[model samples]
Target: MPRRPFSPARNVKTREASQALPPLPLQDASAAIAQSKYFLPGEDLDGLRRRLARTLAAVEAQPQRWEEAFYHALHYAFPGGRIMANAGAESFKANVSTINCTVSRTLDDSMAGIMEAAREAALTLKAGCGIGYDFTTLRPQGAHVAGAGATTSGPLPFMDVFDAICRTVSSAGGRRGAQMGCLEISHPDIESFVTAKREAGRLRAFNLSVLVTDAFVQAVLDDTDWPLVFPAFRHEIGAVPTIWRRWPARDALHTVNERGETCCRVYRTLRARALWDLIMRSTYAYSDPGFILIDACNRMNPLWFSEDIRATNPCGEQPLPPHGACLLGSVNLAAFVRKPFTAQAHFDFEHYAKVVRVFARLLDNVCEISGLPLPEQRAEIARKRRHGMGYFGLGSSLTMLGHVYGDTPSLAFTTAVTQTLALENWRAALAIAREKGPAPALREDIELTPRHLAQNPALARDGHKAGERLPARLLHARYAPHLQAIATLDAALIDDLAQVGARYTHATSIAPTGTMAASVGNNASNGIEPSFAHSYVRNMIVPGEKAKRAVRMESYELLAYRALVDANVDAERLPRAFAAAGEIAPQAHIAVQAAAQAWIDSSISKTINVPSDIGFDAFKDLYLHAVAQGLKGCTTFRFNPEVHQGVLVREADLAATTYEFQLADGSRVQLPGDALVEYEGGRYSAANLYDALKEGFYGKL
Candidate 1:
């Protein structure tokens, strides 16, 4: 009888049977990303999901409200990269932050002040947060520093110090740190700042931007002389010729007016068009130093009564004041499509709203656990309770619904989805405030000023006088331009909000979402961008490693179409509805962004892709058009292979380009960028390997 086969008791809870089996192997690309980027020791894919959902929900003021069903929503609503990676893992570590974006306290002009700012930035970066700084406050080169009795080296050299600091922190922390360096358009060092990235290996850790003012735009359009100015030095204040201009910093050397302009001494003057051309040419070639409409940002700011925004986060999505902080999350729009690629296809907005509402609460909870490094940073969050709840996968979702990106139908669809998301976010904010007291800033009494009246003329039309005192809730809901637009959709909701303030100062900002979209979103198109290509190679930086590895990637739309419609799909030959970033017209991209911007309070991070062959006239015209279209800011990308390796590379571009590699033995080898080479048991694309070595990050990894 073969020893009776050692049969176990029937229905018995045996240890082997009772114990949970290891989670099923990762189901798809998204799982693979989660395992590598997010998972901790002894954690599998499901373990990560459970851990994230459990940990985040436990911090909620009303945990029981979302403890059960919130887990399901996590599948569709993705927290930002920092939030997902750090929210639940605090138990295993110290000095980590859940917030994704922060801005340093206004940098002082003294050397001690500069070093203090750098120290705060280091602590912030070490905690896995991206920070921004306004450098225009510093005196320009050749300016007298009374304390040191020497001419300053100017803001550009200080920026280099910050860049190096970012690099060092990124290397030691095992998480790449990001920084944004902003200089006002009127700064004497603007020219140098505009072309800073042209030099290889300079400012490697920063995303540079010029804070373009409305006055500067007017001067450029008029082709008139533009003054380069800085705050008058204390000793020479009366001797210097001064002009009144809007400035971010204030001190005894400067005096503010009812209109918010400060007195500054002119250092130099140049033809505005010449400066504009320089900006356009440098950006066209280097793909950076994006321009932020500083005037527009301040005018549209919800906290205009209290804050003056001079800089934005690395990607230019969140324009922030000194010491400001914000957490970020996104709802996966592609996950809401029903009956994709069919005549009856439609977005399941009902379910989408549910996820957005839950996500808003989860983000609100993050404020409680925000482990910001500095006391001011933490205080900023506690006061304003600002968070950016955005969405990703607009491009992939549009394709899935049979709409072409940047087309008429696509613009309409984008508008509808964004409007719905914005409204729901506000509603969630209001509901949360009703449960939990409103943000501290909202409860305070704020004074109305001439700037407020100028920003919102409707207030004067309504007989509201400047210098009047009003509750911040009323100022935000009834006076803020963004909320006034929200009132058009739901007057009662806005009224309720006025009676009881919202949970956060800002509700929506679309980030680039590069890594988040690629990994957790299963290669979804980035925020507000069409697919780079149906199939491409992405050079991704590995945390804790020096080198970047090129990974082959496919668009989410292509994967869905292949799985749902055609099993044998050729990526190169797709339907008319399929369009990549390179194929779309510049106007179309701006139109799509404008449609979304109408509802978004915070800025949108979008790059209007232009062909390298596009003429300078056409390239320059895009910025003017963006300004005319009422966009808060605009950024464009044109490939320049000589400048730097792109984050995303199309196979066709790679195959067409050639790379020459110089070995340590003084021998050289030439290969197409797409060619693969195996070395030390590891494989890498020729272009990526060359770039890694040239950039001095290859040998270690």
Candidate 2:
């Protein structure tokens, strides 16, 4: 097939229908083109896609065949927003990474070390990559700041510096910086960290998550008292406060700062359940801080022998070690579904697998092209060749297949689908290793010492195999039985892959998709999630563009239904088989994620949306349930106007309310929609205040 001509379509509307609704793809395009990412100078939509294809095509030894393969991949599913925006663009050779997420180098507790880490984070943010940090290394508030000759103000205060850096960088770039701030649950400042978002307009740039260890979970379940401890000081720095001891996340649980009897202090003891309640109550009120099973993250990490993961990306999907990067993309599942809403509504697993393979190769090329800002990041990525190749439109595909979002069949299907993806991705990675040679850091089998075998029995066999494959033994034991049970696709995929080695270490991760999902996804449900509402009025806040605009675009399932009707076939209607985000139960949401996570080597970026009426105890149990299922992490979103506001909201929800409560995302005006009473014995509304301000009635601060 010949390539399509580069033409930016304007289904946007003429002057006549200008007030009328625009198309979903157009909205997506508009958002993407807002920055020079997807569409560069003199480049139209088709041009952007072709350029992306051309760039990926250049990577092939035989360019023509792979070019066609890559172009086909784009037509079916979109690459991650970073790849779409950065890849094949004018900055194709620039020192900017196509990887979307990364973790900063560990911060030393000293003022100089902390500053240096912040500088590194700034350098990364400057290059447009979001970064995450583990703040638990810093001592508790009121604790000694070893060398600074000062009492500590806690990690929250230092976080302000990072928040500022993010704000400044975001303002400069016109696209705000993205960040993740994580603290261990055992940190003395855990209480303040959990409630940081409760303070309006605080840490506005960060996505907070509590790094929960298995011991913490056990303590919570047993209702036992837990200690909030920090390492004791080693010695003073110059004339500054004494610097305290620091422990790696892997060793933090076991190491005690026993430096003679003189250097002693009692750590605070708090009831585990009480602390758990605080996290639940705060999350219930504001969906700011999330929870990650840090122990689970480490235990499951294939690269655990080399690195320790302390923090995650802005989204919880990618948990990375210091200087780790997350390069990602997804296959569009909706495009591969055939004969919708019938017995023949089967997924094109063969085609999906091919696309996955193409993406695996494409991302390998990206590792070469990604001009990571820092040498450590570039070195880390070069060594590991880490990439994530998960898919989107899962909800749409399920709905189109005439399946419920969270039923047993759905769970089974979800598991099978992901299993196939992982298997295919694994196969592709191994093939790449065979053809293009393995990544530099692919572990060659080395003899393990006697002590090493005693410490980690799993590595008792000489050393890990050459190339970064998941090992034939692990595949046969862990994957084959489940995939064989699917009975849909051939079991040969796993059998064939188990025999080969891999190119990259980590392969699959489900991302939240952000604006790109709306842009290229035809507003498909994001990253293993159902649509937020059937068809809600989405208020798009385009930076520097006019605000308060509303667009009512149909959900992915709705579009699928419309396609079915257009094809002259009757399909199951909405609210019957199709369920949106708010409509689905929280547990159901969790089930879908847990099902999908079975094959995702990294993590799933999903939010279990809870209703305002949900009980506090039940909300707390949700995290425990997630642990029982061996999930990586869980985040929830609830409607609270007093807190930060959300971007997307349902149309019917507003009409069904009396007092309007805006979904808080930090940009909301601190005023009620209704003027129910007088303040200071005078009538007032937000409008009144605005009028007063306009008239210069109040004195300036």
Candidate 3:
């Protein structure tokens, strides 16, 4: 018999479900807040408020000028339209922030605090925020249960429940709930977890990733065996008492270890490389199940002394434990790319460095001011003092300088920009340290090592005499225990500086800036992605109101059907725009990602948008090509929208519930209310008053 698909409405819909799932109580909100203050000095309220006020004023005063400047700078930094937009009313509010949460055991437990969790998710989404979850603690497929007749389903089924919730909630109308889901490597269901999304239509509501541990990675590298374990639980299997085992414990006196309450009957251990190969294969085929370097995540964790980081947020940018929220802000690299005095001129590093410093300070301020959803999130954030400061518009930046994204010159420029950005971030971080004290993990002796002194003979001697030596100051300075204690400075940071010389702890990440970029009118490539196309049709939703009641209306019905049903209107006149990667050649797309990857210290989130004509073999080759180019990860989208049906609803259809409107007064408004409005003649109209309120309340200006 085929098993029925699980529904949240059944079994867990009533208040009984809430009662069944109890919240994991903690000390208090203050403990979490204090932890955030200790680790994340960046979350300083006074500093953040001051910076935000200044930034808001600057943007409001000359919105267009700043938008154009950001657009131009980002274009110059990444000519491929990778960094879509930088600063503007719309850009500032959207894609620049996030809300992260940690589920206890599973969504069932998280559901105990469901109202709070949903409230948090809704609030953040309403403010144009993205969300992430760590679902590692959920039990595997079949196990004994304390409730539910002493039988178990598992995390996957529970995740389906969460997906339904996301679909139904509809954050703030214009905001679609974007989420990340993660599971740990040690979980008994790790393989199933990694391959969950491989079936194409499964888990479409969220992005999936595996939290890879050092043990798991080392086993893969060393070609060794791996173990699978389950958490302890009380059960009686057919009148035989049983206990779920944690791990094999060694007995000191007997020189033997007993496997306590072994649940190995339902588990199997495999060669780590074999599992790794499976992961790579799935990634190659589906462009999903990307890896999180668990060791790397913990090694540089500022709060490692207190808590363990199990997973990252949906986009895989910020790693957090349970109930931890990370606030993110990105600098428009293109904004800093100035044209030289000559028509054919050189890149400007000096000015770029200064802007990066300012941007870093601004991002730090966001943490202090942003409202957190959970006490756990607030507490975890404070303990680590973590922030995601990234860049956008690399493709545009390259184009501004007359450089093609894939060429050697372009790659070199990317490398230079990445290194310079790192240097500037570190310098600023150091200054902040002087003022606020070093991030808990930062070492005392970290200092800037001049570039010329290390590479040039003349500069080396001159620098040494002037007490500004390069190699010793720059290279040796990096090895300092204090700096190393914070975050590992690796190839991503070293590559740019090796040619020159610069140093910084944490640098490089590409964020998904879709809505933000569009608001600024720069086009949407979402960070380091190549433009998906020159133009594509987008669907919008409008609200309608009659008296006090409201209804949701589809824009297509307003424009397309109105012409057919009422006065015939031509749909051809509707505006369309292209995404960089959407229409570009496959090789060019690869080159574009590579060029941007050259400068970024961390992994980039880019999907090579391929046409339907490309074969599986070609897809296979693209993966190899990306790996050869030193890319950490890559995703590809075939033009055949049908392929995405089971995995994701078309963005156009989803957009029907959300939309942006350019008001007659030159202000932008976002509509996400429950009321419906149809688009006619490219304008929104509602049947009555309720619809007006729905549209009016959620519209962004």
Compared with the true structure, model 1 gives a TM-score of: 0.93
RMSD, each candidate, Å?
8.7, 9.1, 17.7
Better of 1 and 3 by lDDT: 1
Taken over the whole model, the C-alpha lDDT of each candidate is 0.83, 0.69, 0.46
- Consecutive 10-residue window with the lowest summed lDDT within model 2: 6-15
Over the stretch 423-474, how does candidate 2's per-residue lDDT look in tens digits? 7777777688778765555444323334224434544354543343343334
lDDT of 3 by residue, 1-701 (tens): 12222222331223222111121122222223222221124443223333333443352345445433433333222211111111222333444333332222123333344445556655554443456666655557776554456555767776666655565454334334566777767677777877887554467667887766656766865899876655443233333323343322211211211423343223557788777777766665566676666555554443333335665556766555555555454655544444311133355577677667655554444344344545555555554345555666565555444455556766687767765665566666656545554443232222333322332244344344333323432332233222332234444433332222322234445666543332231342346554332223322233231222221211211121122222343322211111134335667666766665544444456666665566666665665465556554556665332222111122333334444556669997665422245543323322222233333422321
Off by over 4 Å in 1: 1-32, 255-260, 543-546, 664-667, 678-682
Residue-by-residue lDDT tens digits, candidate 1, 285-351: 9987889999899888888777889899888899999999998888888888876666556888888
Give the winner by TM-score: 1 or 2: 1
Clashes of each: 0, 16, 76
TM-score of each: 0.93, 0.82, 0.57
TM-score rank, highest first? Answer: 1, 2, 3
Give me the overall lDDT of model 2.
0.69
Candidate 2 Cα errors over 4 Å, as ranges: 1-37, 42-44, 91-95, 234-246, 249-266, 444-456, 459-500, 546-550, 566-575, 656-701
